[model samples]
Target: MKIALLGAESTGKSQLALALSAHLRNSGLAVHHVGEYLREWCDTHQRTPTQDEQHHIVQTQIARVMATPADTVVIADTTPLMTAVYSQLLFNDHSHDDLALVHQALFDVTLLTGLDLAWVSDGLQRDGPHVREPVDQKVRHMLSQANLPYQVVYGSGPQRLENALFCMGRQAPQWAKQLARQESPTRWSGLCETCGNGDCEHRLFTGLLVP
Candidate 1:
């Protein structure tokens, strides 16, 4: 199934996508985590994207999803509708952002992240903590208007994941079930061997630290 984690920025969508993908993969499920392409574009440009640039962000995201291996389940960090909603809020010129709804129908499930968590500024692209709630409302409004089936996930990081699984009518995978019983939150760990610093320590989202 194609499960999408979406909503306003810094709502733990990225971390949730990573955790969910990892959990599914551990369960012997073929999963592909389609990350947000706009993040890369913004980081490179060091500025919030213009309406024209936002289209490129959505287009690249579209291409990435299209390019995924057909047999694998997909967990997208954000749906294209996120772009449309943000576009309306930021540029006041959605510029075909509503077209994202056409693509939204393809997803098996969509999870909207809540704004109860901490917000961290990533760069010029972020609107910071204060803007999160209003943008979150916009996301909810847009999703409701489009008649999409979505579940709003809230709580601390681990609880949020459990909520998403429940919303999707899924139980925790074997590994996840085991992790949930553990007392030490830092028990889950991995290091990204490819990072140039060789210090890319990966931690499971036991709590929301940073995405």
Candidate 2:
């Protein structure tokens, strides 16, 4: 499964991505966690990317996912759709939306982090609490317009992780059950049998399952 995490700054996308990846890995699944490329870029440059640089950021984010091994579950901290949203909101440019949405269609699941968490300023990365709502709204509108399905994740810390797991469970019940129980060595068979994921089934048969 390719899981995409989306939301404005300070909404816990990075935290949840790591937590989810850890949980899945603990449950014996091969997982790849992709961090937000834009964050690294900002930290390296000591400033936000310009309008002209947004496209590069978007493409690089997508490239990270494309480069991941196909047999692993990809949990992306943030997808290119975010950069597209920022481009529209910050620079009023909509060019990146087409490519971002096209790439987003490949993901099996999308989880949008809710704005309920308190916003904390991150130097060079976060604009302010004020931009959160606008960014959130833009993200929602774009996803809705594209007719892409996404679950909204809310809460903090462990509660937040549970909520996300619940949402994921709704999509793949057997897989979620195995992760939640974290027991029963034979649970992988059930998850692979009922999850309807061919790659997962292939991994199981090929003895590539990671524990």
For TM-score, the strongest prediction is 2
Q: Write the per-residue lDDT of candidate 2 for residues 51-149, one digit (tens) a residue.
A: 999989988888999999999999998999999998888788999999999999998888888766789988998889999989988998898899998
Which residue runs does candidate 2 get wrong by more than 4 Å?
174-177, 180-211
Model 1 over residues 25-48: C-alpha lDDT tens digits?
A: 786789999988888877888777
lDDT agreement with native, every candidate: 0.70, 0.82
Worst 10 residues of 2 by lDDT: 185-194
TM-score, every prediction: 0.77, 0.83
User: What lDDT does model 2 reach?
Assistant: 0.82
